[model samples]
Target chain A: MIELAGVTKSFGANRVLAGVDLSVGRGRSLVVIGGSGTGKSVLLKCILGLEAPDAGRITVDGRDAATGDREAFLACFGMLFQGGALFDSLPVWQNVSFRLLRGALKRPRAEAREIAIEKLRRVGLSPDVADKVPAELSGGMQKRVGLARAIAADPQIIFFDEPTTGLDPIMSGVINDLIREIVSEMGATALTITHDMTSVRAIADEVAMLHGGVIRWTGPVAALDASGDPYVDQFIHGRAEGPIAALR
Target chain B: MRLPLSLLAALGAAVLSGLAAVGRVTLFALATFRHMLSPPFYGREFLVALGNVGWLSLPVVGLTAFFTGGALALQIYAGGARFDAQAVVPQIVALGMVRELGPVLVGLMIAARVTSSIAAEIATMKVTEQIDALVTLSTHPMKYLTVPRVLAGIVAVPLLVGLGDIIGIFGGFTVGVQSLGFNPSVYIRNTWDFLEPLDVISSLVKGLAFGFIATLMGCYAGMRSGRGAQGVGRATKASVEGASVLILAANFLLTGVFFSL
Candidate 1:
């Protein structure tokens, strides 16, 4: 479980996140829907303590995220960045087993490689792709490798930032399905940020719309259609003329 | 009056920003040292950096030293002839190359080569979010990336400087014997006898300082880079610029410290 209370962050004169209070229950999949530059990524970064919020607190399973052993705290969660963020210098297997190759979770090299191959398989990749660098893989394949990495450690929680941003519709669907399956199978608490409606329908157990640095609406996925909030309505319908302004 | 005030204001702002950059770099360097002294040492990364900053740099350092040494010999011979001091070629060349040029040239070469490369690579990593990924994976970026490269520069560049000094002396010897019509045995003996331990020590010390400056500037510029391809370009440019200027400045300060004291 994750909790954020009265979280606010500002950059220069621009307030990216203003008084954000959000939480995700244990083992639930919460997908945040926001337009570009809506501070969705900032919210995730704040939760992970990657970016410090100006005010308020964030906690995971009751411990303040800002305090405690950083390495131990971070060990509980895995993140798949918007870009794959795979180490270009490393082979795909090394990237996937990065956590296992060092730090407190380190395993022997042979064992780490075996786990990387297994996780790659879980994400629909074969063993042959293991030795190749991330640059040699296609975009979709790279995304798959990233997913494999996120789940490789079997983390208690996983954060997906724009998991299907640049993929085609079919590939996006495949990624969404893979995410849904992995989160369910692992029983991991999942938090994802995306603007894709198709991805939301496919992956989200609960949906929250972010606009004007605040959560406009939040409910079960079934209620997304009839949320009755103007901002959510405008966003889900993709209407040019609505309460939500088009030009960011 | 307004024009002068505006100029003053611009100069003040430049000074302030420069001071801020210096402060940031100082803090970053201190943090890198802290990480270097701590545990979970990344020996593998350090070895890779050693190869990059040391072995891969041999050809360029050697070639630059060789050509510079040859040119210096010719210049000394030509200039000394006017004063009837052409016989002083071996002594001057030995002192000049060992005491100054060897370390300075190698430092500049590393600034141009390794500094630019490290900045570009790390800046690209920052842009692509690999740095954030490293953080999320529970790895300290400073521990994983900066310490190894900085340590390598500290460990390797001095040795390179020593090798460059030797190669440069040999180059001067070659020119002195074959080109300048000087006796080979006399040139060799003169070059050897003219050098002192202080000159060698000073050269190695300059190498140590210059190496630290080059790699530190590269890592500093890179970690502070902005986003996108333009950011990467700027980081690479700033790294080489910073490394070159700092190496030269360090060379001057170090020279005064060694020779003056």
Candidate 2:
């Protein structure tokens, strides 16, 4: 379980997160939806301890997450970035088993490589792709590689940041299904931040809408369509006639 | 009155912000150093960094030292002809290469090439969210990225500087024998006699310090890069400029410290 209470963050004069509170239960998928620059990413970063909250507490698994041995706290979670940020210099297998190949978890190079390849296979990538660098893979393949790496250590919690941002609809659907399957099979707490309705529908057990640095609505996935909040309605229907103004 | 008040306010804010930023960055550096000393040392990453910072850098370092040494010899010989002090050519070349020219030139070359490369690569990664990916994977960006590269720079630069000094002295020797009509044996002897151990040691020390500054500034600028294409470009530019300036400043301070004693 994860809980964030009254978290606030500011960059210079612009306050990105303002007294935001949220919680996600274990073995549940919570998706945060918001338009660009709405602090959805900042909320995730705050929970991950990448960005320190100015005012409040974040607890992961009932432990204070904001201050402590951050490495140990982070070890319990995995993240899949929007851009599928695989290390360009390393081959797919090395990238996947990066954590396992290091200290405390150190295995022989061959054993680490074998584990990496197994994870890749789980993500629908072939053994042939294991030796290839990230630059050689297509966008969809890279996202799979990123996903494989995320699940390599069998983390208790997983964070997905815009898992379908740049992919085609088919690829997005594939990724969304993969995320759902992984979350269900592992029974891991999943938190995803994205604007894509399809992704939310496919992966979220619960949905939260972020606006003005605070969650405007939180309910089961089914309630998103009928939430009746003007902002939620405006955002979900993609209508220009509502309170949300077009950038033009 | 409005302009003056605004200016004062801006100045005050700038000072405070600068101090805050420095404090934050210092904390980040300390954390990185601590992680480096702790377990989970990424040997593969370290090896890759060594290859990047050491082996790959040799060609540029060698070429720069060689050309600079040859040029220095030519210039010294030309200047010495007027005073009929041509016998000082070998000694001056050796002193220049070991004491100042080799380290400074190699440092500048690295600042130009390696610093910009690291900055641009990391800034692009930042813009693309790669650093965040590392953070999310339970990897400390400081440990995974900055530590290996910074540690490699510390280990590799001194070796490169020593190599540069050798190449540079040889360059001067080549010019002295082939171009200046000097006895090769006598020139080598004079060069050896003029160089003190202190000069070589100073060069190595300067190299290590400059290398640390170059890579640290690069990583700092890259990690702090904002989102988008323009942000990455700005970060790259800032990194190169910052690294170059820091290297020169550090070189001066290191030289002063070494000679002051």
lDDT of 2 at A125: 90
Write model 2 residue lDDT over B12-104, tens digit each, in one string.
Answer: 999999788678667866876798898767776788888988899999999999998999999999999999988898999888888788888
CAPRI category for model 1: high
Alpha carbon lDDT at B156, candidate 2 = 88
Candidate 1 lDDT by residue in tens digits, A174-200: 999999999999999999999999989
lDDT of candidate 1 at residue A186, scale 0 to 100:
99
TM-score of each: 0.99, 0.92
Among residues 3 or more apart in sequence or in different chains, the pairs in candidate 2 whose N, CA or C atoms overlap within 3 Å are none
The 10 consecutive residues of candidate 2 chain B with the worst lDDT sum are B24-33
DockQ of 2: 0.64
CA lDDT, every model vs. true structure: 0.94, 0.87
lDDT of candidate 2 at residue B105, scale 0 to 100: 86
lDDT of 2 by residue, A1-248 (tens): 89989999999998888888899999999999988998888888888887888898999988998778876888888889878889887899989998787744668889999999999999999999999999999999999999999898889999999999899999999999999999999999999999999999999999999888788899999999999899999988888887766672
Q: For residues B67-165, what per-residue lDDT tens digits would candidate 1 score against the true structure?
A: 888889999999999999999999998899989999999999999999999999999999999999999999999999899999999999999999999
